[model samples]
Every structure is written in C-alpha cells, then in structure tokens.
Target chain A: DVKVTQSSRYLVKRTGEKVFLECVQDMDHENMFWYRQDPGLGLRLIYFSYDVKMKEKGDIPEGYSVSREKKERFSLILESASTNQTSMYLCASTLRGGQGPKEQYFGPGTRLTVT
Target chain B: DQQVKQNSPSLSVQEGRISILNCDYTNSMFDYFLWYKKYPAEGPTFLISISSIKDKNEDGRFTVFLNKSAKHLSLHIVPSQPGDSAVYFCAAMTSGSARQLTFGSGTQLTVLP
Candidate 1:
C-alpha cells in the first residue's frame, strides 16, 4: 500500500515563531499539496506543487509557504505562526500524469497549536 | 462563495437504514466528483468517485449519484452500520489539464443500532 508520512502528528509553536511540517510520499506521485482545515470551513489548499521546484498558490496562500525539493517530499512552512493559524494541516499527493490519474492520497494530519 | 457545498453538517441514521449524503456545487466547469470518508484523526480516504459522464456509480454498499442539471451529487450508503460512521466530504474537479479539486465542508454521519 502507498504510504504518506508526516514529520509530526502534533505540533506546538509560539506566536511569531517559524514552523515547518514535513511530508513524504512513497508512491512517487508527482503532485503534492498542503491544506489547512478548520471547524466550519473545509480543507483549504495553501499551496501545491506539480513537479519538483514548481509550485502554485491555492486559494488560501496568504501565510503559508511550501517546498518540494525532491519528488517524494513536500514541506509546509509557516513564516510567523499566529493564533489564527492553529489548525489541522494535511498533505496530499496524486499521480502526476494527467486528468484521470488525479486521485489524491492524504497523510495523517498534523494538528498545530500556536500559543 | 463556496464552489462546493454540503448543507447538512450532520446526519443520523438507523443501523439497517439507508443514509443519504448530499452535496452541491456552483461551478459549471466541474466535470468529476469524488466522495471521501474520514475518521477522527486519520486523513480523508477516497471511498468512491463518479465522472461527470456517468450519473451513477456504485461500490459495494456505497452508491454515488450525480445530477449535472442541478449541479448536485449524493452518496447513499445502504444498511448503514456503526463502523461506517464518519465525516464525508464531496469534492469536484474541472476538466482542465491540471485537475485541481475543490471540496465541500464535510457532513458527519452517525449510525445508531
């Protein structure tokens, strides 16, 4: 079975501190995404990368940045953590070929709390 | 505006009854719809999917129906069981090459015996 591994399942950070959440997929999928999920709002994409070193901004890209240095790993970074940014973060990967291969596999989310 | 919407935040059903989960979308360009089931801490998993070309798709006890005219889709679970309780999310993707999916706010389903 394909596995998507997250660096941390729970993270606690101080306000204004920088935080990094790492994700690695073993299936060699070319597309990787980062999203933040809140109570009422659903999973909102922060950023996504279709290929190594190529990234695109999603709807909610205001406070988050992402890195995809290698094909298997994608990382989400919070420049300055804030209280409002405290939420569950998820990483997903999909096979990169074309439209029909767009099935996404998600990682166990990381819940972050900014104090 | 939310591109996709799941109006019901929660739904309760008897264990042996059918549970219907509904979802609507405002985007006309969306051509593919998918349903995902999520447990408490684990990430959402893909349960079933239907392309815009087909109105209905079934996998075992789960069936997904799509209506393009109304811009709506629904998932029906037959003989709902306690183990089937979870949050369900409906997602849509347009026919473009990149294929980015837009998701609706999930609906929590509870099955009682």
Candidate 2:
C-alpha cells in the first residue's frame, strides 16, 4: 500500500507568522499536490510539483508557496499566516503514466489554525 | 461561479437502503470525473472515476453514473451501512497538459443503522 505521510496532524500559528507544512510520499510518484479543504469550498489546489525544484500554482495560490527539495517530499509555506488561511491542508501524489484521470492517493491531512 | 457543484448538502438513508449522491458541472471542457469519500479529520480518498467515453463504472457496491448531456453525475451506494457515512466530493478535470482538477463543495451522507 502507498503511504502519504504528513509531518503534523494539527498546528496552531499566530497571524503574520510563517508556517510550514511538510508532506512525504513513500510511493515516489512523479506528481505531488497541495490542497486546502474547507467546508462548502471543497478542496482547492494551492501548489503542485511534477518533479524536484519544479512548482506550479493552482487556482488558489496567492499567499502560499511550495518547496520540493527532494522527490519524496513537498512542503507548503505560508508567507504570512492569516485567519483566513486556517483550514485543513491535504497532500496528494499520483503515478505519471495515466493520460487524463489516473488514481490519486492522499495523505492524512494537516489541520492548521491561525489565530 | 463554482465550476463543480454538489447542490445537496446532506442525505440520510437507512441501513440496507440505496444512497445516491449527485454532482454537476458547467464546463464542457471537462472530460474526466472522479468521486472521493472523506471521513472526519481525514483526507479524501479516491472512490471511483469515469471518463466521458464511458457512462457508468461500477466496483463492488459503489457505482458512478455520468451524463455528459446534462453535465451531471451521480454516485450510488447500495446496501448502505453506518460505516459508509461520510462526505462525498465530486471532481472534474479538463483534458489538457496540466490536468488540473476542480472540486465540488461536497455532500455529506449519513447511513442510519
């Protein structure tokens, strides 16, 4: 079974602080994604990396950035945390072979609270 | 506007009954659809998916139906159990290089035992 591990299950941060959420995938998939899940908004992509040191912004990537120093790990960085950024963060990975829609595996998710 | 929408917020079904979850999308460019089941404090898991080339895909007790003409899709769970209670999200992706996915708000389904 493939395992996507998130470093923190729960985190609390103050406004204007820098926050980092780390995700690691044991499957060594080529595609990695970061998404924020909120009630009534579902999951919106923040950033994604197809390979190490390569990053691309998704629909909602305004105040967030990503770092992928290694193929197995991806990190989401909140430049300045705000109350609005408080939400559940999810990390996902997928195999590179499929054309359009392939299977996507996800991590346990990190619930971040900004005060 | 929300590209992917699950109008029904919640649905309740008794044990052994059938539960249907619905979703809609406005983009004609969307060629792929997927359903994900999520439990409290957990991430959404890949339930099933179907491409526009096919209308229906079934696995065990779960089935997903897609209607391209109406731009709608539905997921049916027969013999619903209490363990099946969770939030279901419908997602769509355009057929392009990026394959970026757009997700619905989600519908919460509760199976009463």
Candidate 3:
C-alpha cells in the first residue's frame, strides 16, 4: 500500500515563530507538493519539488518555504508563523514519468494553529 | 482568481440514489481534470479523473464526464452510500507545466440513509 506520512497530526505555534512540517513518502515518487486547505479556499499550493534540492514556488508561497534534500522527504517551513497561516497542511506525491493524468497520493495532513 | 470552481458548497442525496457533482474551470490550457474526496482531519484522496481527450470515464460506481467546449466536468456516484459522504474537490492541471493542480473550493456531499 502507498503511504505518505506527516511529522505531526496537530501543531500549535506562536506568532512570529518558525515552524516546520515534514512529509515522507514510500512510493519513490519524483514529485512532491505542499498545500494549505482552508474553508472556502480549498487547497492552495505553497510549494513543490520535482527533484531533490529543487523547489518551485506555487500560488501561495509567501511566508512559506520548502526543502527537498532527500527523495523520500519534503519539509515545509513557515518563516514567521502568523494567525492567517493557520490551516490544514497537506503533502502529496506523484510518479514522474507519466504521460497522461497522474494521480497524487496525499498524507493524512497536519492541522496547524497559530496564535 | 480560482481557475476551478465548484459553485455548490453542499449537496444532499438519499442512499441508493445517484449523486452528481459539478465543476467548472476557466483555464483553457488545462488538459486533465480530477476529483478528490476528503474527510474531516484527513487529506483528500483521488476519486476519479478524466482526460481532456475523452468525454467520459467510468470506474465501478463512479463516472466522470468532461465537456471540453464548456470547460466543465462532473462526477457521478451511482447508488450513493453513507461512506460516500465527504467533501469533494475538483482539480485541473495543464500538461507539461510543473504538473501542479489547481483545485476548487469543494462541495460537501451528504448521503442520507
């Protein structure tokens, strides 16, 4: 079975604090992504990595950063956590060499609360 | 601007009936559409998908229909079950462009027995 696991199921951080959320996948997928889910906003991509040490900013990358130093691990960093950053963070992975639509497998998600 | 939109925020249907969820996209570059089902405290899971080249794709009790001209897609669940109730999101992606998916706000579906 394919599995994507997050570092934490729930997290609480203070404003202006630096926070990191980690994700690991056993599928050996070449692409990984980070998204934040909010009510009425669905899921907004924050960052993605298609290869180790390569990162690309997504639609909502402000105040967020990502690291992909290893193939199986991806980490999302909040430069300075703010209340507005409180949301459910999701990590997803998909195989690289696919012609048609590729399916993304997601982790259970990390619910972060910033105070 | 939301490239994909699920206008209906919620939908209620009776068990054993069909449930149709609609989605619309504004980007003409999109070549693929996908639907995901998400439960509370869990990440969304891939439900069904349709390629731009095809109009309809079916898998078991789920079928996805795509209309290229209208840039619209719909997912139909036959004989909806209680376990089928969840928030469904519609997503679209452009070919050869980072493979990043643009998602909709999502529609909460309820299957009442």
By lDDT, the better pick of 2 and 3 is 3
Tens digits of per-residue lDDT for model 1, A6-94? 99999999999999999999998888999888877888888999999999999999988988899999999999999999999999998
Error of 3 at A73 (Å): 0.6
lDDT of 2 at B9: 90
Clash pairs (backbone) in predicted model 3 = none
Better of 1 and 2 by TM-score: 1
**Candidates in descending lDDT order:** 3, 2, 1
lDDT of 2 by residue, B1-113 (tens): 89999999999999999999999999998899999999998888999999998899999999999999999999999989999999999999876545567899999999999
Top DockQ hit: 3
Clashing pairs in 2: none
**Each prediction's DockQ against the real complex:** 0.67, 0.73, 0.83
| TM-score for predicted model 1 compared with the true structure | 0.98
Which tens-of-lDDT digit does each residue in B19-88 have in candidate 3?
9999999999999999999999888999988889999999999999999999889999998999999999
Write down the worst ten-residue block by lDDT for model 3 chain A.
A95-104
Give all candidate RMSDs, comma-separated: 0.9, 1.1, 0.8
Tell me the lDDT of model 1 at B47.
94
How high is the DockQ of candidate 1?
0.67
